[model samples]
Target: MEITLVEGDITAQRVDAIVNAANSSLLGGGGVDGAIHRKGGPAILEECRALRASRYRDGLPIGQAVATTGGNLPARWVIHTVGPVFSSGEDRSVLLRDCYANSLQVADVLAASSVAFPLISAGVYGWPVEDAVRQALTVLNAVDPAHVTEARLVLFGADTYTVAERVAAGFS
Candidate 1:
C-alpha cells in the first residue's frame, strides 16, 4: 500500500476504515479508544457492549481483528485490534506487529481502499514511540498494495508525527 505520514486525529480521519488501538475487552478506554468512543457517540459503546455480551474474549488472539461501526466519525467502519500490553514481554513485539497485520487484513476483507492507523501500543500501552513507529511501517510494508491503496499514519502530537515521518522516509 502507499504509506504516508499525516499529522491529525485518527478518530476524525476520513478513510474507509480506521484502526482502533483497543484494549482486548473492546470496551471504550483511554487514548485513541476513548477519543473514538467520544466522537462516535454512545452507539459505538452499546454495540461493543452487546458484542462483549456475546462471544467476545477479554484477550483477543494475536493477529486477530474485529469490525465495528464508526458511529459518529467520518469513516464508515472502525477495525478494532488488540495490541500486546508492555508487560506482555518481548513477544509483545510480534503481537504489536500483528496489530497492524490483522487490521490490514480486516480492511482487505471489508474492501476498504484506504485506511488510517494510529501508533498502536504506544500511548497507554507504553510502547516506545520510535519503536512503535518502526513496527507500524514494517507491517505496512508487508501489506499487499492491491488490497489497500492508501494508508495514513495519523498522529496527535508533533513527536509522534516526526517518528511517522522518519519511518515513512525510509519506506519511500
Candidate 2:
C-alpha cells in the first residue's frame, strides 16, 4: 500500500476507513478517540455500545481492532484499536505495532481501499513521537492488503507532521 502523511484532523479525512486510537473501553476518551466520537455522532457510539454488549463485553483488548459505522464523519467506516501505553521499563512495541497492523486487517476485511490513522499512543498515552511514527510505518510498510490501496498517517500538528514526514523519508 502507498503511505502518505497529512497534517489535519483524522475525523475530516475522506477515506474508506479512519482508525481510532481508542482506549480499551472503546466508548470514547480524550484526544483522537474523543474527536472521532464527537464528530462521528451518535451512530458510531451506538455501534460501539452494541459491540460492547455483544462481542466486547469486557472491552477491546490492547492490539486488537474492530470496525463500526463512521456515522457523520467523512469516512465510510471507523476502525477502533487499543494502543499499548508507553512503558519505559518494558518493551510494548509489539502491541503498539499491532495497533496499526490489526486495524489494517480490519479495514481489508471491510473491503476498504483507503485508511486514515492517527499517531496511536503519542498523545495522552506518553509514547515518544518519533518512535510512534516509526512503529506505525513498520507495520504499514510491511502489509500487502487485498483491498487497501493507500494509508494516510494523519498528524494533528505541524510539528508532528514534520516529524512523520522526516521519519517516512527514511523508509524510502
Candidate 3:
C-alpha cells in the first residue's frame, strides 16, 4: 500500500472511507469526532443512534471498527473506531494497533481503494502526536497491500503534518 501525509481537513478527503476517532458511544464528542459529525451532517448521528438502539454496545475495544454513512462528507462511508485514551497505558497500544488493523479490514471489506485517517486519539485523548504517528505507520506497514491501495494521514496542523511526514518517511 502507498502511504502519504497531507495537511487538510480529514472530513473533506475524497477517499472511499474516512475514519472518525469516535467515542465508545459513537454519539459524537470533541476533536475529530465533532468535526466529522459537523461535516457529515446530523444524519450521521441519526444512523449512530439507530445503531445504538439496535444494541450496538460501546464495548467495541480500542482498535475495532464499525461502518456508517458519510452523511454530507465527500466520502461514501465513515469507519468509526474507538481509540484508547493515552492514560489507559501500554495495553492501550494493542487496542490502538487494532484500531488501524480493523480500519483497513473494514476498508477492504468495503472495497475502498483509498482511505484517510486522522491521528486517532492524538487530540483530546492525549496521545503524544509523535508516538501516535510512529504507531500508525507501524500498523499501516503491517497491513497487506491488497487490502488497501492508498492511505493518507490527514493532519490538522503543521506539527501533526510534520510528525506524520517523518514517520511515513521512516518507512521508506
Highest lDDT: give the candidate number: 2
RMSDs, each prediction? 1.9, 0.8, 1.7
Model 2: per-residue Cα lDDT over 1-172, one tens digit each: 9999999999999999999999988899999999999999999999999999999999999999999999999999999999998999999999999999999999999999999999999999999999999999999989999999999999999999999888989874
lDDT value, candidate 1, whole model = 0.84
What local lDDT score does residue 86 receive in model 3, on the 0 to 100 scale?
Answer: 94
lDDT of 3 by residue, 16-120 (tens): 999999998888988899999998999899988988878585445567798899989999999999998897436577778788889989999998999999999
Model 1, position 82: C-alpha lDDT score: 82
Which residue ranges in model 1 land beyond 4 Å of their true spot? 57-59, 87-89
Candidate 2 accuracy as TM-score: 0.98
| TM values, all candidates | 0.91, 0.98, 0.93
Higher-ranked by lDDT: 2 or 3? 2
Clashing pairs in 1: none
- Runs in model 3 deviating more than 4 A are 145-147
Cα lDDT of candidate 3 equals 0.87
List the global CA lDDT of all models.
0.84, 0.95, 0.87
Best by TM-score: 2
